[model samples]
Target: MFEGHDPYLVALSVVIAILGGYTGFGLAARIRGTPGVSHRVLLAGAAGFLAVGIWTMHFIGMLAAPIPADTVYLVLPTIISFLICALVVGISLFFVSIGEPSLRRVISSAILLGVGIASMHYVGMHGLSGNFTMEHDDSMVLLSVLVAIVAAYGGLRAFLARQDGIRLIASSIAFGVAVSGMHYTAMFGGHFVPLSGEGHHHGVSGLAASQQILSIVVAVLCFVIAAGFLLSLVPEPRRRGARDSAGETGALAPETDAAAVDVVSPQRDHAGPAAPRIVSAPLGGLGQPQRPAPVARLPLEGADGTHFIDTANVRSVRADAHYTRVHDGTRERMCPWSISEAEAQLDPSLFVRVHRSHIVAIPHVSFVRKEGDGAVIELDGPSPHRVPVSRAKIAELKARLGLARPHA
Candidate 1:
């Protein structure tokens, strides 16, 4: 029985897993920041990297084993294994990306991914056709399955984790180790028996039992992962904020990314805050069908149909994660524009930004009074609404309303 495994290949397998995890997770983190086509593309790319990492790790681990020459890999089974992994991974990521990832959803996604990965490994193992028969200890198989599930849990959590730089690196390393550990654990339980009669003929039309070909494939994939890793390390492009009707050039907001997890965009001090969260599957806010530019009427989706509200009727716009809530002198309705986008598109003179999360209209203001360190404006809509104003913007607000103190 062949017992010894190549140390270098084993190490390489782990390294590849880490690289792949980092690249995949990195791409996934940006899924919540971008909109529409870019979002879908990132999702596919992330899933592809993750599945390839898992499949490649399994294959490399197999090569590390001291299996006899002439062992052929069945084409169909090998392909099937990868497809299974990719399908499950994609589904899991998709689930968490849409809406807020509840605890139940996270656990369910983790379990599905874990079971799928284990299935992929065993199926690929079954693809080996040679002069030896393989048997696995039932206990060891269970242990490996458990390990796979646990590792998959970590991976899913990592996807949901705040995708900061250091944390991402840490999660990727932990993920890689756990994944490789499962592969080796199962291998430790496998026993091979030499067969004297004619060997398995299923691989006759499959892979040409050549280690060189396997090596080439692994090398090429590793290069691709490395390239993707480098690209992910680069800074994302800055986004230009929309120009207002007043023709005043708005300050550019930092770029946001869409993601598979409950995502939150970073705060921008200069521009109205960027709260570009990916709230729904395939995204509805920024991903909605294209419509005419919002010059006079701002479209709001209601339960029955799309309602376009007159911008002049807009009393105040409050930030709600990626979307905004508008008080239109009657009722508050959900608007898909981000806070920064609302600031940029709406008339700046009529609608002034008083706080990072609150925008107010001068015409609708019933009263302005001090509130603690900052100030609050009482809006005279049908159902009156009060909006908080930042202390920094109080002077500007006073000037806009002809209430500024005369120069000293």
Candidate 2:
């Protein structure tokens, strides 16, 4: 029966479950669609919040159980359980954050997480000390593990989908249920028997229920607060000018007036048949000045040789740390220049920077598809490729492609 259950501690466990679930899902969302060091740091913080929350909940639940007067928890095993939980959850999040998602990776992450949860539970149980022996129902243990696996998979899928705020909150509730259900069900399956003896000496001094509860609550609160602060540091997307804003489309913006054309005229020198001097003038009376043809030669140098590539043949230019990778329809070559530098040199009418890391040729882009908070540009060639569009750049890209007018 639930003889020793403290309603207050039980309520605290439920609160911990809810907070933990929300923090876990929030971490997953922050980690997705992000790259480099920021992704890694956010993933670590999220894993820490989840693992510590689970461990705290388990220990708090144990403290709520009715036990013999001599019962105590060994310090080392309890500490080990917490470490195991953190390590396992951290590994699972890391696997999910890198590259494209796949079923095999999801299953693998789930198994690792499930095993970690079961191990933490059993190890914590082993930490119990008294003149008593513990036994567990094999069927119940199997069932708990199965629940862990299913719950882990479901949570991962929901978080990875990067749904809206309401869906994320709902998934968090489901996650909380999964975690709490597994814990209480496992507890129900366990039986503790007092040894047949007159008296027993308890060597280890365990904290009183109140002290344990207070310490765990404070620690978990600190962890949650720290995670929240870190997540807040993630930068918001840059704000773009309205589509109707002047100069939004770079060179693609329509001409409002005839551009002044520079025309050179030869002047006869007054002194003794000197070579004719040249003077320049702006030809405003002429019809709209002819637009210059798009620049054709892209000066690039690689290990093989320095050459001028026809800009029309360039499919994309990707920023690669200190250098840029210039991709043609058939192959890619590394140039010593940065992407921004190349962007300045390229014809704005033919190419546009779609993301911080990428610039695509307008002619090569076949279509654009929205995904999550961003969009992807599909390029047409022998081998089609997709390039990510930054949230801030989406409007600008549309304007460049003549798909939408600039908005305020």
The segments of candidate 2 whose C-alpha lies over 4 angstroms from its true place after superposition are 1-4, 202-408
Compose the digit string of candidate 1's lDDT tens values, residues 23-81: 98888775654456787898899999999999998898988998878777777888899
Return the TM-score for each candidate structure: 0.61, 0.57
Number of the top-ranking candidate, with TM-score as the measure:
1
Local error of candidate 2 at residue 61 (angstroms): 1.7
Please report the candidate that would top lDDT against the real structure: 1
Candidate 2 lDDT (Cα, whole model)? 0.67
Task: Give the clashing residue pairs of candidate 1, or none.
Answer: 31-258, 31-259, 32-257, 32-258, 32-259, 33-256, 33-257, 33-258, 34-258, 97-260
RMSD of 1: 13.1
Cα distance off (Å), candidate 2, residue 243: 11
- Residue-level lDDT of model 2, residues 1-408, one tens digit each, is 345677787777756766776777687665643445777777887787778777877777776667565666777787788899889988887787665447899899988998888788889888887778888999988888888777777777766653346767787777767877677778878888766666754445553233354456556664674466456446554332221121223223322322421111111121112122233433477543343434566655532345567887888987654456667764455555545445555676788777767889998999898888889998877656678887777887888788998665
- Global CA lDDT computed for model 1: 0.75
Instruction: Write down the lDDT of every candidate, Cα atoms only.
Output: 0.75, 0.67
